[model samples]
Target: MLMRYVMSSLRISLLMMIVLGLGYNLLVTGFAQTVMPERANGSLILNDQAEVVGSRLIGQENRDQAFFQNRVSSIEYNGASGSPNYAPSNPDMLKRTSDAVKEWHTQNPDVQIGSLPLDLITNSGSGLDPHISPAAAEVQIPRISKLTGISPSKLKLLVNKHTEGRELGFLGEPAVNVLELNLELKSLMPE
Candidate 1:
């Protein structure tokens, strides 16, 4: 009787593992692939040559004066997606923020530090966040305009064009995808 009970328990465990572990994963993957193939495949952005340039989902370092910069990334935008987890009082965090502020002042002498967006000086919880608040993008417009010779008005229009409204109309604040914005900006550059 004990032998029979043990065998029954083993059989149930195997059945559950096959059904829940393997079957569930297959079902979800199939549904996602069929329903949203582009998203399932990483939402890759392509250039005119159809070459994969980057993903709409990941952030990258953009230091060129001609382009709007992204938020400070603790992980250097390697796509690892993490924060430094520093406390508000941590000296290291304070130093990093100070350094970022100094760099911003150096790079954007025209914009006052008081008006600078917090996102420009702080790292996002996910270091790979590709979007920045619309305000953040706007704050950099003057610098980008001066460097690229694009009119400030035209750059503002571009920022507005690239800005996305909150998810489902109310979930999050408006944000501009830096990668997409930069790509469009590149086209507007003098050739």
Candidate 2:
């Protein structure tokens, strides 16, 4: 009777493992692939040549002056997704913020440091946020226009085109996807 009970327990454990681990995962994957294939596949953004450039979901580093810059990413936009979480008075945070401000001043001399958006000089909570507030994008327009020779009016139009509204109309603030914006900006540039 003890041998039979042990066998039954083993069988039940194996069945549960197969059902919950394997079967559940497969079902969710299949459902996701069928219902939202693009998202399930990482929402990859492809270029005109069909090359996989980047994902619409992850933020990436863009230091080229011609393109609008993304927010400071503590992880260097590696997509590992974390923040330093430094306190306001932390010396490391202070130094990092000071360095970022200095770099912004150097890069954007025409825009006053005070006028710069806070997001431009700070890392996002996730350190991989791809969207910047529209105000942040606007402040960089002059620099991008100067570098790329795109008219400020046209750049403004482009920014407007790429600006995404708040989720479901009120869940969050409106944001601009930097990757998508830069892709469109590239199209306007001469090869």
Which number leads on TM-score?
2
Instruction: Give lDDT tens digits, candidate 1, residues 1-191.
Output: 99999999999999999999999999999999999999999999999899998999999898788898999999998768799899989999999999999999999999999999999999889998899999999999888988889999999999999999989999989999999999999999989
Per-candidate TM-scores read 0.93, 0.97
**True-structure RMSD for candidate 2:** 1.0
List CA RMSD, all candidates. Answer: 1.5, 1.0
Worst 10 residues of 1 by lDDT: 75-84
Worst 10 residues of 2 by lDDT: 75-84
- How many residue pairs clash (N, CA or C atoms closer than 3 angstroms) in each of the candidate models, in the order given? 0, 0
lDDT of 2 at 114: 85
